[model samples]
Target chain A: MKVKVRVVPDGRHLEVEAGVKALDLLKLAGMNSESGVVLVNGRPVTEDYRIREGDEVTVVRVLSGG
Target chain B: MAKCSICGGPAVAYIRYQRRYLCDRHFVEYVESKIRRAISRYKMIRQGYRVLVPVSGGKDSATVLTALSKLSREFGFEVVALHIDLGIGDYSVKSKEASIKAANKLGVPLIVVSVKEITGYTIPELARKARRPVCSVCGLVKRYIINLVAVELGADAVALGHNADDLAVYSMKSFITQDLSNISKLGPKTESIKGLAVGRIRPLYEVYEKESYLYALLTETPFLHEECPNVDFSSMENRLKVHINSLEEEKPGVKITMLRNMAKRIRDYPKPQLPISRCRHCGLLSSGDECSFCRLTKRITGQPLGPRAREVVRSLVASLQLAPRQDSAYKS
Candidate 1:
């Protein structure tokens, strides 16, 4: 029950447990749902979206500027 | 996968505020509609007008340029893009390239101005020489350059890319700091004063930052995704943005509602009409005998570089080869 998670701009990669909500996945990667969006297989999904086994998850940071 | 609210198609996004899911095509339409509504609500553009869009190679600015370019023909206006190369190392280089790509894709004429060439100092250099923070120096330089270029080009309005989240956070910060006058300037549009400042319009006024990013990505608009190297993540504004977005997570559409309410009551907090005059050095708007740009340059360079900067921008504008107006592009 492991999924691949990749964060954009920072280019970080992590392996997290499947069935975790997208929001929780972001938290595990040291990001907040408020500042970024979660995409499953290149399509944006809500924070409540649950990851599946072997799913490719990407987190794109939206909050920018100083 | 979620289904599009309007059609039984695979959805790309779920707009919590609207309680609807939208496929890729529908999402683009929704964003464009919001842009059109903001323009109509503010009466931002008019027929036979030229708009100067200053692009910074960021998602917000890219989204603004793309939307405006599509609507320009329909709205009976021309769009010209301006990209100021602040010379922040590779960041500036990438920014200029993205600006060029976006402008080329839209077939909009673009003017490029190099701060280093005009002032003999990059933004960071100027900040060090002037003993001011980099962000402060950059802001002053951009404001002066934008206004100068817009005035010289005879642009009727300058389209900015400040999205809903940015404006809301700015308004809240201004309120907390008791900067009521600044809050007065935070609406969808600001009118131009003859011989002084050109009108400013925010086409992305109703669009959120996240939505802007998504639109830019889905539309394949070229933009630099990297944050400026000078960003201070610990700053109050960044903290405020996080807090504001957290509130939005709980209550969808709060940002838009708050901004709309603020716009409704904006005139109640009118900024005092300060006595404005032309800067003797550059012949642009100034509050005192000299504009802040001129004063800052004079302090750092031993002479006011405002006049030189204006001349540089003028020549850049003059050299632009604008495309022929294509009225047919707007035909429905």
Candidate 2:
């Protein structure tokens, strides 16, 4: 069971095992869930959300400003 | 598996408004082109203009910085950066560090200004002396410094990184307050007044908040993610954002639609242009005799007015012009 994960802006692509948590994917890409939003299939989900095979994942930074 | 609507590659995002699936490459293309279109549509940047981008050590600003850096190379516009240090303990430390890293990464020159150094008051210090809430004062200070820096740096315009969600939230708050004046000012580009002010632009005006975060990460742009240690969750804007987020969860593109309505309203009823005047004291643009920055600084620092300051205060009082009255929640 493999999933395709593409981390944006940096444009890195990864193939990971199924059951990989969104948080773990972000961490593996040198990002943290605390600062980034993880999306599974275009919908926002918690970091603990698990990936299924062929799932397309994107980890984006959360928005804030002065 | 849903395929990209553009390229038919594996899709990474489903744009609710367009009902389109986008793969990694196509999605990146879509976002960048959208930004380019926004800049042209709004006439935000012209060839060889010097634009000052303020970095908040967050994804929003970093995305703007990175995007503009990429664009400037080919377009011949100069992009410089300024990072304001609010001096909020570790928050400032982390924010300044991230801002520096991002600017350095982009090879953009950055100037760091501290509230304490510039105004003799840090944000917390100003908050303590402020009659209004901290966030309001914070907003005032940021805008002031942005204007002040733009003047000092000789920038033709200031570029902000506010994304769609931020704009939508601002629109919602203005709507709730029935602040038509504020609503009129909302847009992608604010044309620079001939005598009084540098223009303002939002390069990411059409971008979503989530997409901005992803852009920074994808570009390996460094940014701080920690919530402001001094954030007052009790503020009207914060509460509204929470409610809006819930609405967004239930209905995708709710924020975008709100923004669209805001734009439509602005188009339907353009604001009467106000004459911009220079502040006698600071020589910056002012609506009245004193700029909002000068008035705010005087109030927070408790600086007694000289003949000049007194004249400004008198003008403000006579005109009944005050910083837009904060809602009851902002009463200190």
Candidate 3:
């Protein structure tokens, strides 16, 4: 039960337990410093979104400046 | 598992209002097509016109630039960019570099303008000297500099990165303050004012914050992840943002609904015409005796703009006036 996660642009990827949340995966990959929208399989999900086996996740920043 | 409404692929994002899940590729197409529709629906872009997009090396602006660049190929319009260096040490340097990288990636020409060089005072210096908040001063400087740059470049329109969240916050604040006069100003494209040579466009007006960020990431657009050192997250906007996020969590697509209503109200508002007067100091059109920027600079500098400064500003205004009146189509 391993899930594949990749952070775009950074091209960083990792495998984590299927039960892990998106935030947990990001933290494990050392890419959790900034705030971003986590996408699982092709849809945006909350950080608490559970990662199913074979799920592909991407973390993208969502903040805007004036 | 949810399926993409269009492709029947693995859906990555769920659009509550549309009541459908979108796969990564379909989501990208959805966002880009939405941008295209918003632009044409609002007449944000015109044929044979140059648009000035201010890039701050942030995800939102970068996404706007990338989208516009992609559209420019088929639309037959030019997209140029302006990046302001406020001289805030590493923040400014890194932000400028990111803007340069994004502009280069998009293959668009970018002009980097320095506040200290043009105004004789860096943002930090002016913030320390002015009684107003640092964010206010920074906003003033950025608007003034970008507007001047747009005019100098003969741009027909100035595009900002404000998205659905930003407009929603603006509406919330305006509602609380009971200031309805500004409501008409919130929309996809603003009418060209008498004084300014160019109108303004919010191409990302309907796009959500998360969607824009994801667009930037998936497109590999270079942008800064750092916030301004002087920014106050406790400000009214930030507070409203938190509140809005909570509400959005409870009911997705609330922001979009609010923005839609706001836009409709604006469209129904009666147009108000006012006489415009030139600011004596800068020779720019002003509703007051002196423009807000001039007054702010004077208050901070503690003196009239010297002859040289006056001449510089006057020349800039003169050049702006000489630019072609390309935004006449949108004029109210």
What TM-score fits each model?
0.94, 0.74, 0.80
* Candidate 3 CAPRI assessment class: incorrect
Residue lDDT tens for model 1, B64-177: 999999999899898989999999999999999999999999999999889999889999999999889999999999999998888877788899999998999999999999
Model 3 DockQ reads 0.22
Best by TM-score: 1
Ranking by DockQ: 1, 3, 2
Global local distance difference test of model 2: 0.72
Model 1, position B8: C-alpha lDDT score: 69
Stretches of candidate 3 off by over 4 Å are: A1-18, A21-36, A39-49, A52-61, B1-3, B8-11, B195-197, B267-275, B302-332
User: Candidate 2 — which residues are off by over 4 angstroms?
Assistant: A1-36, A39-49, A52-66, B1-12, B20-23, B245-251, B270-275, B299-332
lDDT at B70 for candidate 2? 89
Stretches off by above 4 angstroms in model 1 are: A30-34, B322-332
lDDT against the true structure, per candidate, is: 0.87, 0.72, 0.74
lDDT of 2 by residue, B79-149 (tens): 88889899888989999999999998888888777777666678888778766777777887788667666
What shift in Å separates residue B126 of candidate 3 from its native position after superposition?
Answer: 0.8
